[model samples]
Target: MSSDLFYALTGASLFTLGLYALIKHAHILRKILAINVMGSGVFLLLVALAAGGQQAFDPVPHAMVITGIVVAISATALALALMLRLREASGLAVLPDTSPEELSEQLPEAPSDVASKNNGKNA
Candidate 1:
């Protein structure tokens, strides 16, 4: 019935949805998006709690939310960079455990001359 309760419930619901999505999805990009959604939900809850029946707005939670936003952005950028690098190196977005032989099989074949040169030497 109250505004505070409404905002809190909304935030909790968003957090639950995001958490479920994060757990159910296997893709790295989806996981990142779910994490961002969860962060937004936490931010909403923080703001709602800070505004609880108060005439004057509190700045502490506001500052924390801002800091959280900056951290989320930085984390997202780092995760995206790592994802790109992984894709380039493995030609796949998702990582899976595979033996060295399996990995080598996925890679492009070496030049015949290079293969021959290495054939006479011990690994």
Candidate 2:
């Protein structure tokens, strides 16, 4: 019934839920959101650990949480940029859960001229 315990449990639950979503979802945006959720859970847990039953807040944990938030923001931005690049290249938002061979099979075939040009031969 204590606030710290509640926060700790909630943090754990968030982390677990995020982990499940990260594994279960194939969309890049969903995965990114899941990762952000996981980060938030960790931050919450950190804060809970720093909180010492009504004692003044520990500056270290607060500092660490701030740094983590900044890093998470940058990482999320980078992930989103990468996802956009992937979308542009593949024209899909969801990742395919297939082997490399299956992926190769799914790709469109190149034109004869393009194939020949790529083979280091004069077109």
Candidate 3:
């Protein structure tokens, strides 16, 4: 097969794999990583397609890829920071596949909750 075809297929495969991982995983970090993988696949496909054209080399796709890389890095940093905050607040990284109420019940009681309960008993 041609190199362009090979690269395109690889890009498609990567996108599919990333989609599957994004659906199958429960961890927030894993979801973030899957998103990154999907972005990479799209970037690869764009570059491959641009290179495969039968005309003068185009710089648009390359510029887009570079811009996408910068955006991806920023997005990743934001996602990781959100995950860190979630971990600190809940001590959990994986998402719950249940109702919001049930998820809330699963988390540990806060200091405020304990203090309120003690005050109620003493008062």
The top-ranked prediction according to lDDT is 3
Question: What is the lDDT of every predicted structure here?
Answer: 0.79, 0.81, 0.83
The whole-model C-alpha lDDT of candidate 1 against the native structure comes to: 0.79
Question: Per-residue lDDT tens digits of candidate 2, residues 1-123?
Answer: 778878988898999999999999989899999999999999998898668486677899889999999999999999999999876555556676985346556665633333344454533
Query: Mind giving the per-residue lDDT tens digits that candidate 1 earns over 1-123?
Result: 679878977898999999998888767788889999999999999899889888999999999999999999999999999989876554456544565456556655633334344554535
* Candidate 3: regions farther than 4 A off: 100-123
User: In model 1, where is the ten-residue run with the lowest total lDDT?
Assistant: 110-119
Model 1: residues >4 Å from true position, as ranges?
95-123
Off by over 4 Å in 2: 100-123
lDDT at residue 101 of model 3 (Cα atoms) = 57
Which of 2 and 3 is the better model by lDDT?
3
Models 1 onward score TM values of 0.74, 0.78, 0.78
Better of 1 and 2 by TM-score: 2
Q: lDDT tens digits, residues 23-86, model 3?
A: 9999999999999999999988888887884568889989999999999999999999999988
